[model samples]
Target: MNRVEEPLLSVSERRIATRLCVDAPLGAGQTVGLAPQQAHYLRTVLRLSTGADLALFNGRDGEWRARIDALGKGWASLAVIDQRRAQQPEPDVWLVFAPIKRARLDFLVEKACELGAARLLPVFTQNTDVSRVNCERLRANCREAAEQCERLSVPEVAEPTGLRDLLADWPADRHLLVAAESGHAPPVAEALARAREQAGGRAGVPASAAPWAVLVGPEGGFTEAELDALSKLPFVTAAGLGPRVLRADTAGIALLACWQAWLGDGDARPPFRG
Candidate 1:
């Protein structure tokens, strides 16, 4: 029987750390009060008493270590001890997906955050089954996933928009990677490689320089007219996942993983400085 070696933990994972994404400002020696729901989570659900240490991040500021100072019936207070990590740059990858059933949509949002997507945009396609989406719930899912994954920032979850509207106002500089369910489309890796070459020299460039996005359609996939419209876009690249068709949730996760591996922060070594 061979023992499987576990990968080394990053610097942020060594301690008995619990993280919370809060709305309040954070600074050293600053006292911040938690919302009622957040306080309930820490005090009742987590059984964390006063004087316990936890980490906090507001999506804008970096991670901070805070000590619980007071635990009242419906609220809790914490004093910021120090900053853990300065705000780090995340990949400039946006995940745009057509909303599906409730459970699958929740899964998609969670996985997107763990994969370091900077934004999650829901687009309504012609074949999209789920017309309505709860943006607030999706935002909560993103925050929870970020907390569990030790991510310093939470992906911004946007309101659902029509595919036509999104394309009409799409930024010219941002590259859109469309997940093609058809067989004739190029592989995801190859498509990303081509986009990278067109953008600059190598892959994994700084987020500011090369902003990229992945668009996954609904379970029934895109209609011919919709596909044609997407294909005609100059900034869009149609890429296939594999030979077999994948569920909407699976395709979204697979596409994101491919993009991160090819041009995002999936590398083991530090990205080239020069």
Candidate 2:
């Protein structure tokens, strides 16, 4: 983390790449389209050819630098070669767990998109034991963990709904933390300072946006009538990330790393620059 932050990063053991390898503003004539196992992990396990470079993201387009334009007989292409680091602003968090089994539900969607969680929502609780998941293989492992964790944006995984219709249409301005095992909650920094005192200062609408959804319960949890209808939700809180009892994928990455260590931006943000 010195040497002036190593000029962001690069590394490339011929696609062994680093810093999510290639941040946006590219260079050699642009074009990048891959998938089909990342064009077979770049033409048969990183043996790339036809101009190889590859590293792009379109979750609101940010990181780039591409090449390999067209390698026939099954597909492999790229071009866009510039723009490296310009898409930032992603902390409208949301995780909403409850879908275990199968490699901890792909390590809880790769640690909730590597702990930035802009949306994942896969709840089907009532002590859920897998009601059906594999949402396109967890959306291709959240798009290979947002292109190896440099993430411009790619969390939005929803569509499992029904923890009583996601708390009977709960959206009283987002902020639903809920990691309750009911050993008398409230301790993730006083439930995020009482959700910024119920967001009474209005910063980003939808009720002064901040702490948004982590709610992980299952592996025999949450069902005293779904913790009394999520304790009569007034935008539910009930935190608690201590005293052992985690196991719905380690309480969904310990409630997304304690809500990214107290209302994420994961310590001045970096992993998933969007």
Candidate 3:
């Protein structure tokens, strides 16, 4: 009979590592509490014992070294040993996409976190299929992804907003990049270069000045009127993602990777020198 080896830790271990490695300042004898789900994960799933090590972070706090204190029905606790690593912020990129079905939407959240998006914005367009959002679930997904990806901060998942509302009150100085289905649009690389140029000068730039947002429409894409309205905005630059017609989630993630490759921190700190 073949034996299956148990993972050294559970997927939830990522959360522990994130806390210790990405967010909290640890010291020997410090402690952290785990929520119900986390407790269950350690006890039931991973079968971790007391005295095992776990990691932890709190966004503001630096990473810390923690050890499992105890495991219970729906809760577990950890004692912080020492500081591991300091916190470092990612790019100022934001992902604004239309909500799709539940499964795909969940996938989008996970991928967005992995892609280094600082924030996730859900926009409702005329052609959009999903109207409501489960903010709590998406937030949980972001937390898990952050833990696994070694992200210092979890991306902010904003409440769903109407597309028109988003545009009308849009920040004038912020750059908005819209992914259009038309192949006529400029490539993402070019758009990033242009956005930086439009942004201008280092002195006036906000630390968050990268203040950029990428919009991926619904599966069917933007309605003609919606596209026209988006295009008319001077701050908006529509970019093409090559030939194929991508589903809403796929297009959103693809554009994120492309944008990151060009204008994001993932690149050699390209376009803008700091």
The most accurate candidate by TM-score is: 1
Q: Tell me the spans in candidate 2 whose CA falls farther than 4 Å from its real position.
A: 1-55, 58-68, 100-126, 129-136, 141-151, 156-175, 178-200, 205-210, 214-222, 225-274
Candidate 3 structure lDDT: 0.74
Question: Which model scores highest in lDDT?
Answer: 1
What TM-score would candidate 2 get against the native? Answer: 0.38
Model 1 Cα displacement at 87 (Å)? Answer: 0.2
Q: Is candidate 1 or candidate 3 better by lDDT?
A: 1
- Predicted candidate 3 versus true structure: per-residue lDDT over 1-274, tens digit per residue: 1111323243433334323223334455866677787777778877887877666777766566577878778877787766555666567778999889999999999999988888898989998877799999999899989878777678998988999998898888667778888737887767666665655622223224566778899988898899889888988888887778888888889877876765666533321122
Q: Residue 192 in model 2: shift from native, Å?
A: 13
TM-score of 1: 0.90
Q: Residue 195 error for model 2, in Å?
A: 4.8
Name model 1 segments beyond 4 Å from true.
1-14, 199-203, 268-274
Model 3: number of clashes?
17
Q: Once model 1 is optimally superposed onto the true structure by TM-score, how far is the C-alpha of residue 102 displaced, in angstroms?
A: 0.5
Report how far off residue 267 is in candidate 2 (Å).
23
Which window of 10 residues has the lowest lDDT sum in candidate 2?
A: 12-21
